[model samples]
Target: MTTPIHITHVIVGLDVGGAERFLLRLIDAHRGNPQYAHRVISLTGKGTLGPQLEAQGIAVTALGMQSLRDTPRTYIRLKRALQAHRPDVLQCWMYYADLLGGLAGRRLGIKRILWGIRNSHFESGGTRLKRAVRRSCAIASRHLPWRIVCVADSALEVHARAGYDRSRMEVIHNGYDPETFTYSDTGRHRLRRELGIPPDSLVIGSLGRYSAAKDHHSFVQAADAAMRQRRGLYFMLVGRDLTRENQALARQIAATPHPERFLLLGQRSDVIDCLSAMDVFCLHSRTEGFPNALGEAMCAARPCITTDVGDARQLLGQGGRVVPAGDVPALTQAMIHMADLDATQLQAMGARARGRIADHYTMNHAVDRFESLYQTAMALPY
Candidate 1:
């Protein structure tokens, strides 16, 4: 038997974010595969998902990084961990990890190192330190790591403009597992019942963490406008920091014309069920690389509407609607138009959406591409 390719994944942390979730899915798909063995190293403490990974019998090491002041100590710790593991490849996720992990792997003389980029645009409200780290990664990109993997084509273009080496960059969209995210009548019925949504009503839902970029305020405005013009139009929102306790979000919801019709299911475990219950799913982010929730919703066979951000238009592709980002009026019109569609039209559109995913974005497709990339990278001379 061939020796397994050992991959040590390094990340800033294991927080419940897009990049973290993507890492989990990528590694989980490799279970029982003889060609690859994987472990994780978190620069910060073991976050919410670390224990979950450990539960699956995957090794997870945390360096307990607190702040930038601890860089020297953390760098030493990361280097020691890499030396002890002696992985064949060091895969770093996000900018900070790329900078730290690339240096460590190079110092240890590891020939194969890959950097993962998860966002197309810099955060509009990011901290100065984050901007500095991103600039540093761009400079390091010229030499560190054998390849850079982007989650979307838009990400590749954006990073190229930011001075990342376009020659070494590759695009690999996020893929979904149909069995885990497909439509289910049981899930739909149960979610509607649990949320007290009327059987005859139409629900337009959005799934993402509440933040400035996600533009939850704009979503609320659009939902409010759509609700004012039509009855039986409900809005469902699911993600962290989206609860009524968030004063700003709560105020927006309360000010909506039909407040009772809005469902704020903050950060749920049964996301598939929540998605299944939606008659339409929307991705309203002002920025993204490749959105997992949008794809998962499409996998659930929900008719989707997304802002023209990241690769959403490329992903949706004749499946559903696309509107300009931050345009509340445009989004409101799209929501109203979607709600006006009959059951047959909505169902047909949803089926097409899922079919597109099955054809182009299955987890198997992504895994195959990744495996092929790894094999090719290993064969290349240093």
Candidate 2:
């Protein structure tokens, strides 16, 4: 048998975000494949997903970088690790890792270097330091990696406008494992009961980190508006810093007439179960690359309502409603429309949503594309 190619992935961190979750799925896809071997290097502190990777017997190394002050040292350590590993291909995720990993791979004369970009829009509300770093990455990206892999076409367009080399870009939408995210009546009933929700109530769910970019405020506003028009409507939000203890989220909930109906589950492990319990899924992000949560919800056979951002409309594809970003009234109207749908209509929409995912967004399809990309990159003359 031919020897497998060693592919090393470098990322900013292994946090439980969209990019991180996709990385895990990608690694899992290559688990038993004899054509490729994988290793991961986390540039920052070890995150929750690191242990999960280790549990799968995947080698994961953390640089333990504290802040920008450690950049010089971190680069040296990363370069040294690359030297020792002598990987055939270097794949970097997110901006920080893209810059550092690209430089390190070049330093070692690695022929195949790929960068993964997972955001469509860069919000103005980010810190000055973050803005500067993104600018740097954009500048460096033009000359770095052999191929820049964007998770969404919207992301590719945005990056091209921001000075990234469009010639070197490839669009690969994020994918999901249908088996893991499939619908379950038992899961729906059990989770609803566990959350103290009545079986007869309609459940609306939004999943993403509590950030300005995610526009959780808009979700709360829309939910509040929808609730005022209809009773037996409940909103369940799951993500980091989405707990009732969060002052910002708490304020939003307090403004709602039925705050008790809002269930704030902060960073759950049972996301599939939570998704199954939802009658309708919503993504109100001001920006996105390709929302993994929205796709997962669709795979779980739930009707979705999302803002028209990134590739969300492409993902929805007549399966759900899409409103303008940050437009609370439009979002509220969509929610109300969903609430007004008959059970048969709702079920039909959910079926279509699941069909969309099953047709074009399977994890296996993503893995096949990536493997082909890897082989193509390796075949190129450096």
Candidate 3:
């Protein structure tokens, strides 16, 4: 057998979140690529999905994070891992991974360095501290043979708007495969019974780590408003809290009125079933680059009512509705609209979201693009 070409992906963790899962699915899809075999390096502790990656014979390593905040040691630890693996190309996912991987790739003499930027709605301009964060890693990106890849156009635009060089950045839409995530009415019935959500109740759902950026609280606020408008409505929240920040938000959520009505299902395995339960899926994230949960909900054929952040408008196309990010009133109105929607109207709108995902977003498509990019990089003079 011919030897596989080497490409390493550095990420913060193997958590079952958007970017981590996306990388795993992409790696799984491209396993057959003769040009490069993939390795994943987790900068922090391994997440729940670590075992699955190992089971598939994918190499994964963790830095065993010692502190909550990033320090010089974090970069040094990542650099040691990079030196050992010595991959031909390095791809970093999320902010912490990007900064660390970029610095390590430069120090280790890696030929290609790619930073995946997924957050699209961060309008928090750089103060001295934020600028320091960007400046700390900007040198590695600019000086080395590096590229910044955004999963959505809005993400790419956000990077440029934040003074990142346009020429060095690219946008690639994450694809959705119906094979991995399919809509199931049968699953919906099963989940509704488990949660005691009436079959007739309008289900509004969002799935993500309880993070500030995800702005899940905004979704909760919208649900509160919707519940007032129409009593007995249901809302489901999936995914676990990973950090103190997200945990703080969850605590606040639980303390609110009718917390029981808001089902806080932490780190669920039956995502498809939960998606199935939602009649009208919503994500009121304050900012995003690409939202994996939003795509999954659409795949489940729910009428998507999302805040206009990330690549939602572009991705949703004409399939669903978009409101301004964090606008509780608008999100509330959208939720009420879903409450008012009959089965007929929902089916019509939802079919569009499902069709859009089936046609565009899929692991197969994303993997293909990545494979091609790797090939082009390998063919170039190093």
Candidate 4:
């Protein structure tokens, strides 16, 4: 019998988020690499990257499911996919992908499955149920011959504490393409004008889906304080479509002093353009594995001020601030300090962030690490 040759990547969705972006990068990096034949499976329907990948002549499949909880059916559909693909290695990302897809892959006799843990402990600690889900992941994960890959050290430690074998887990930082996100003077001015801000106005911005854990409220509070002391400084909150929480945040911002100065630019396609216009970047997320926006902004040479979450401190180093999560007062001070830095100091910090990626976290670096890991993991006798 021919040995089952399966090495398929499985993700939950293809939305315009960090993980989805990573999927695109992973595919593009390894598209022509001779080491393996690759395909992508999205449990949810095709995402924005679907056409892009298909354009590269890579195979893309979507299971057409609605919800992660839409199980048994999801399970059955996934079973069919596994049987058809018959992958030797199944890589599972995020929660639903890790649990359901990992189980399905194992049942289909995939030997070298790897679980991607992208969330942090703080977010997982919110309630008994979420913690229970984490436990379930730990339990379901143990029954299979698998390795765990986390995007940050915190996530690895969390998995280890949850009874995962420490030897089986490693931290692989996420990466971005400098070519795609480099800052341009023209792009900055154009984006600033588009947002109705003048060239001289200090633009402080944050990007990321405005989920509760992103802690955008703290950003509002920090920008509010900074604006009082420094006029003509503007704040833009990017990344979020129309949502009830967005409306609520708008109301909250409107009631604050200098309401008109605060802008919420929802779900931008030209994030690098937006970053180019910013004098300061911020992220107040309560938790994360590694923030793509923060890293991208850094790569774009924007000085960042963020709360300590996920791998922020390690990633930012002297390039940005890392305060305790939800500490509005500390966050405010960090914002002001970053904003008040001398030109030379600010430029130096931005340079530091830019160097971090080139050395350790660019897309090529991340893809190389993954490819090496895959090749090494596959060579093991099962």
Q: How high is the CA lDDT of each candidate model? A: 0.90, 0.90, 0.78, 0.79
Scanning candidate 2 in windows of ten residues, the lowest lDDT window is 121-130
- Write one digit per residue (lDDT tens) for candidate 1, span 57-132: 8999999899999989999999999999999888999988999999999999997999999988954558999898
Quick one: ranking by lDDT, best first? 1, 2, 4, 3
List candidate 4 stretches off by more than 4 Å: 1-6, 122-130, 242-245
As a whole number from 0 to 100, the lDDT of residue 205 in candidate 4 is 85
Q: Each candidate's root-mean-square deviation in Å?
A: 1.4, 1.3, 2.9, 2.7
Better of 3 and 4 by TM-score: 4
As for lDDT, the candidate ahead, 2 or 4, is 2
> What TM-score do all the candidates reach, one by one?
0.97, 0.97, 0.91, 0.92
Per-residue accuracy of model 3 over 73-92 as CA lDDT, tens digit each: 77887888888778878888
RMSD after Cα superposition, model 2: 1.3
Q: Per-residue alpha-carbon lDDT of model 2 for 1-382, expressed as tens digits?
A: 9699899999999888999999999998877788888899999966999999998888899998888789899999999999988888899998889989999888889869999989897645577877887888888887778899999999999988988888999899898888777888888889898899997789999888888899998898989999999889999999999998899889879977999999999998988888988999999999888999899999998999999989999999978899999999999999999999988999999999999998999998898889899889778876
lDDT of 4: 0.79
Q: Name model 3 segments beyond 4 Å from true.
A: 32-34, 68-70, 121-131, 242-259
Count steric clashes of candidate 1.
0
